[model samples]
Target: MGIFKIEGGKQLKGQIQPQGAKNEALQILCAVLLTPEKVTIHNIPDIIDVNKLIDLLGNLGVTVEKLASGSYTFQAKTVNLQYLESEAFKQDGRGLRGSIMIVGPLLARFGKGYIPKPGGDKIGRRRLDTHFEGFIKLGATFRYNREDYFYGVEATQLQGTNMLLDEASVTGTANIVMAAVLAKGTTTIYNAACEPYLQQLCNMLNRMGAKIKGIGSNLLTIEGVTSLQGTVHTMLPDMIEIGSWIGLAAMTKSELTITNVNWEYLGQIPNVFRKLGITVEKRGDDIFIPAHKNGYEIQNYIDGSVLTISDAPWPGFTPDLLSIILVVATQARGSVLIHQKMFESRLFFVDKLIDMGAKIILCDPHRAVVIGHDFKSQLKATTMTSPDIRAGVSLLIAALSAKGTSTIHNIEQIDRGYEHIDMRLKAIGAQIERV
Candidate 1:
């Protein structure tokens, strides 16, 4: 674990670029196993989780070549299937939740796939049932080992079929899509997760010779192909990171321009921040957030109810950015209820904000009511530990707008999602040090 020592009450001004989407990278990297030919990828964020997956791919005998700073070419012509049973693989594969997606491509190509219990942030009960159930629906035999905590799926040949998922899980949809693309017949997936990441995956697969329809909708149709060829794919900018920067600029009283943000894909994110009375200017493809010198005010509902910010599926405010929204609302003029409907434990980080003098009530595991101080009372800096990826960045924002220096332990959580976060913050004049 690492710690970040931050000196607060600094007004920053500059332009920053959002990195490649982390969620998308996880899906796209695993999708590399679908083809044996060279697949080149660009704009890959050099973060911990992504690098871990890349390393896991290399360990599985995929030839990986770093073409440039954010470009890599992957070829999986000679994969060592025997390594899947090794203890080293079990240890390595358990580090990321995205590791589950690898099973789909492996099972499709090799007729069998094995995975240890995958690990991720303790935000909530993220069920893998959706992935496995989708596999079973596609004619794969699923088996789980209780003692080893491993999951295996195998079939002589997968047959594509119609599946209406219980929930629109992003990785689950990606996994089943990968499997269905090489199956025997057409697969119709209703209630699919159609986020821009999935759209990009579908587009890339289409370029690779997989026939998929419905690029940006909840229903996806995939036609099983004999084999997919290699193709080049570039990731879009990270919308969650861009949203975080917007909240950071308002809370810290900074004028920051987030460059190349892929405005079309950032659904409701800008409007969500604007509802909190922050000024968001869209200049072409960039977003310029001016420093809120007079402080921001929360806009109440038409019925005079307290503002409620909640998370939902794509086209709704992402649950990942609700933490940032909660932290930003602490300095606003009115109260707002942040309902983290997707995760049960994510709202607990508000207790750290209360420790820093922000008035927040933990209504429950899924909800927090924030009473903004209107910048009349500055938060007092204190020592805290980061619990997860989004919460870590939210705490960082709080510390930057606080009255004194603060230390945040367990900064590895932040590093997993953001690439060179401290360096990026420093470039925009934030006083943060990795200690």
Candidate 2:
């Protein structure tokens, strides 16, 4: 129920480091349940989602120890599967969609899994059908009783088989991977989500003695093993956070040096930003943004016309960032059409942008065309509630660069993803007060 009051139109300066990837860290935390041995994860972001996941693990009796800042050691040596039915367990699991990943691990190790509908951002119709389909293909029988979804598998006798996922649901792909790692026979998962998060999961599983081929590609072949040993792993820097920071700097005309950014995983981000005329300089592992008084311009198409930035699956501009890109497009000089194909309601927040005097056309539920009026940013402070994590941050960015004071309530949604976002923004000269 907290709110952020921000005085905008301030150019953020100085250096900031994005904490670890939220999606990757949550998936990795569930991987800890795959083994009873100790697994130490470094660079873990202290965020709501991650904490909720940790709470989920604790409910299952996993021993978690917070070491230093951004580091934690987990020992799930004795997992009590019975706690899955607890009201507290169900409430926390339902709060996060990542809790579904635990279903596969629990079913694989304990032969049964039960969890209510998982919840997270209410962007659109996020289906668990794909996850259930993949698990069923792996020889598990699913049952739905009123609100509880249960999976009962004779896991000891379960045999791995080829699974072609209907869609590349990120968590669904990861769920099957965790379930297949300890199955009896070989498991082949085609059309898999090979994002950096999944790659880290594979790497951690490999260290724990799971045979997985195709680290960073769509098709993955997993050879089942009898048991997995504990291993230590560190999560990669959050590319989405880095991209968000890049967008932030470009929008505010601020010079910021983003440190510890893993340049290797940043596929297509540089090109995507280039389309918006945002220039980035690479200084070793860090990216430097030079301040610009004149707003950035959107690169035109081959016909010297306005361009469009749309979201696609992996190896493309992520849908999760389409909201941020839309907000960034408002400050650019030229026009660009932003598309949010994955979620039906994601483009709804453009009304807030339009209220800030941005020139935007809501083409449909999933697409919005933004024309940069380059309005003098005469933003009057207004009270708005955050809708989702990405959209919430986008609004925050717009608020920081706008004039006057703006109050954003329901910051817990924003806290779910970005780590210490307000504190980090304040480091770069953003005037944000939490109430």
Candidate with best lDDT: 1
**Taking the tens digit of each residue's C-alpha lDDT, what string does model 2 give over 107-167?**
7777777778888998989888887787788888778766365433434445789988888
In model 2, which regions exceed 4 Å deviation?
Answer: 147-156, 375-380
Candidate 1 wrong stretches, greater than 4 Å: none
TM-score of each: 0.99, 0.97
Distance from true location, Cα of 426 in model 1, Å: 0.9
| Distance from true location, Cα of 255 in model 1, Å | 0.5
Q: How many residue pairs clash in each candidate?
A: 0, 0
In candidate 2, position 112 carries an lDDT of 73
**Weakest ten-residue segment in model 2 by summed lDDT:** 147-156
lDDT for model 2, please: 0.85
Candidate 1 residue lDDT tens string, 183-285: 9999999999999999999999999999999879999999999899999999999999999999999999999999999999999999999999999999999
Task: TM-score for candidate 1, please give it.
Answer: 0.99
